[model samples]
Target: MKAKLGISPIAWWNDDLPELSDDVSLEECLRQSRSAGFTGIEKGRRFPDDPTVMSSILKMVNVALCGGWFSGTLVNEDIATNKHRIQPMIDLFKAVNAPCIVYGEVGHSIQSDRSRPLATKPVLSDADMKAYARRMTEFGEWCAGQGMPLSYHHHMAAVVQFEHELDTFMKCSGEGIPLLFDAGHLAFAGGDVLRVIDNHHKRINHVHVKDIRGPVIKALDWRTQSFLDAVALGAFTVPGDGSLDFGAIVQKLAGYGYEGWFVVEAEQDPRKNPPLRMAEMGYAELMRVTTKAGYVVEAPTFPWR
Candidate 1:
């Protein structure tokens, strides 16, 4: 099946949220995203929190509600707290008619705190994984009732950063909960994107198609800086400008029968590269890569390249 292309509003919100400026309003962001050839957009917290309002705005823009990121501290936080955090987002998804909610580890680590003295160590232990799995099972059941799916986002700096962590999380996660494969984040965290897809293609429910500069990634590693620090330094860029092998990765995802949004999520400075320009470049590259991989390309209604 052909997958739809979408852009994450988080890209604009990075700078837009701090300014609280009129320029980055939800309506404006959606307008720009649609004009930039994106069929859908991922919701950000800065967007309207009220589902009805958010849905109405999206309907007006002719944009679909692609799934979005939600902060979940399942590893360290208590089950009650986690449940409370998850239910509202799930309700929002149902209200907006979004198929899924992308989740990631938040707050504390599941690994030993000593692994990275400066940063929070991953807290995802075997016991913690089991508890998380149970919580996920409950969440999945809740999502099913709402006609939505919960796709866990394995992130860098989070508990499931590296390949081993991903393996553990998958092995311990609830049976039906799907995974959100983010290629750039996986590469930044020192995991092979294609390998991960090859090994666990069955679990992927959605994907975040981000690309990063190879040398920047290496330099960031050499400095041992934080992920946010790297972002501030311009580690990510439009797909073709970066070193990632998207042609191979897209083909792998297709082989697995994956049918979900390919979200362009390059978190960079808008001052350096305006939102519209970045979107244009990224959207074009996405089409090129997907087309090169032998996937049927959909003609975008908005500006592309």
Candidate 2:
């Protein structure tokens, strides 16, 4: 399976906290992404809404437009309303020729709640899980009809974060709702990455290859700090700098025939972890790992790069 490396703009500008990289420009983001040997970019709030303008900006640095995080309210709202909320992003994805859209169900999540501790993340009852799964399936199928796949992102403070929670959600949801395998989030939740791969590799259509500092994670007071608090404390880092065994992870992904963008997505403070340097570090490490796994990092026939 061939793979391409992509870097998320969140390293430059975070979505949850706009003040993180407030000084960085869009031109800087794209330039650094390409300079770091990335062929694609997972856009964030700093990205333009106009597809034509977005394309022109990214084209300047040979960076293809990859998907970004999309927050969904399926568990609390109607499917039609949810579709309406995401249609603009769908339109943007279509115009940019992106592969798929990464969706995180954050209707009741405390991931962004700086006032509340992450340990207080919302939970669903058995009946609520079933309802949420059904809604997710129906909406994901609708997204598929628009020629854009919706890979459900299991986030730390979201409804489906743990391994068992994901198991239940995926088992109950329709086939249209694929999984977005994010290594950092899984490790942060104390879930096994390989275990998820062994169980749900067939349904994984997108990947977020982020690494985490185990000590920072071990010191995190999820009972007293929010997700952003941990981020502020340097909980996440680039691939090779952290404790994740990404080489082994890549080998497992290759064995499962995973073909798509391996997005380097880690939400870190740009002031402490410079975006360009970390992007290069992540690219170098991922290139080494993917090459060892028999996959070449090459540019696909996309709109740009």
Candidate 3:
């Protein structure tokens, strides 16, 4: 099996909670990621929207563009509106040759709202989920036609947070909407990570190798604590440092012939866990696990090199 290691800029600079971010520029983030042995980095707010500018910035560290999140409001919005809103990112990702665009449905999501409790997250009925899934399939198809595929992200504090909700959404949706397998979010929502991969391995186009602190997650009172509260309590960390067994996770993915980017995407306070140190630790753990999985881990190939 073949694979590539990547890291998300959210570890360095969080867009949702700016206070958790490190005081660093876009170039610095890329440099640190590369220094930690990651040859690819995901998009962030500091990244230039212009494709040319973004490419130039990434070239400085010989890092390739992997994937980035798009807050999709397709739960309530129409296809045309979302299509228009996503055109720039589609164009940018296509230009950079990214694997896929991470689609996280943010409509009525309380992930960023500190005042709202986790128990108060939005929920939809079976019929409602079917309708929403149809729309998502349509959107995903359109994105693929535009040369940028959509990988749906089932996040905590969102509509499709739980395992049953994800299963229902997947059953309703078609192959057009591929899944972005996130181990941390699924574990945080009380789902079996291995079970999710076993069920949806067919539709998984992208992967987020996120790890979480089980104790911190279990200590949170869903009725009174928010997702951000859990984050503030150091609920998440990179692999090998936290509770997830990435060795088994990577081995399972390799068994399915999965060859794509395995991105480290732990979002926590940069002050508590220094970004450079965390990046190195994540890269080390991934190297250990991916090597054990028999993956020939590849590095970035710069066109101008």
Candidate 4:
């Protein structure tokens, strides 16, 4: 299997929590990513909206645009509103040839709300999920038709946060919407990482190989603390430095014939764990694990499109 190694810029500069970010420019972030041996870097708040400008910035650092998050609200919004909102991101991704847009469900989500407790996250009933899933499928179909397929990101504190919730979402939704498998968030949600991959391997188009800091996660009071609170307490980290066994995880994915980008998306405080150092660690661990899984890692290509 062939795969590309990538990292998200959240480690360098977090959009949700500016206090946890490193005071760095976009060029410097890309430069550090390339220096850490990451051929691709996902979008962040510092990235310009114009594709040409974004391409030039990436080219200077010898990296490519892998994928980026797109906050989606299919739960509360209609298909028409979603299409209108996502068209610009679709155009941008198509221009740069990104693998896929990470579609994070943010409607009624308390992921960014520091005051709200984790246990207070919104939930969908069986009937609510059935209808929401259909809306998401249609939206996914439209995004695919636009030449920028979306990978649904089941995030923490979102409506579809838990393992059972993901199962129901997958069962109700069609293949029109693909899955963005994130190991850390799944682990934080009390999910069996390997079991989740086994259940939804067929629909997984993108992967986020984030690792969890088990002790910090265990310390969090779910009823009093928020998702962001767990993050503030250092609940996430790069592979090989945390709880998950990426070697076995990669092997499971390889056995299932999955081939695509495996991005390191551990959003941590830059002050405690330097972004470049964390990026290097993530790259090395992924190289070791992916190679063991018999994957031929590809080099970054120029002219993103």
All candidates' TM-scores?
Answer: 0.87, 0.97, 0.98, 0.98
Give candidate 1's TM-score: 0.87
Pairwise lDDT winner, candidates 2 and 4: 4
Write candidate 1's Cα lDDT for 97-192 as tens digits.
676888766667422122343144455677777777777767666666667788888876766788887887778776577888989988887898
Clashing pairs in 1: 109-122, 109-123, 110-122, 110-123, 110-124, 111-122, 111-123
Q: Name the regions of candidate 2 deviating beyond 4 angstroms.
A: none
Please report the candidate that would top lDDT against the real structure.
3
State the lDDT at 117 in candidate 2. Answer: 93
Hey, what RMSD does candidate 4 come out at? 1.0
Instruction: Give stretches of model 3 more than 4 Å off.
Output: 301-305
List all candidate RMSDs to the true structure: 4.4, 1.2, 0.9, 1.0
lDDT of 2 by residue, 140-206 (tens): 9999998888988998889998888998998899788999999999999999999899999999998
Residues 118-199 of candidate 4 have per-residue lDDT tens digits of 9999999999999999999999998999899999998899999999999999999999999999999999999998999999
Comparing 2 with 4 on TM-score, the higher-scoring candidate is 4
- What tens-digit string does per-residue lDDT give for candidate 3 at 1-305? 88999999999888888899999988888889999999898888989999888878887888998999999999988889999999999999988878889999999999999999999999998899999999999999999999999999999999999999999999999999999999999999999999899999999988999999999998899999999999888889999889998999989999888889999999999998999999999999999999999999998565446
Clashes of each: 7, 0, 0, 0
As a whole number from 0 to 100, the lDDT of residue 50 in candidate 3 is: 92
TM-score of candidate 2 relative to the true fold: 0.97
TM-score of 4: 0.98
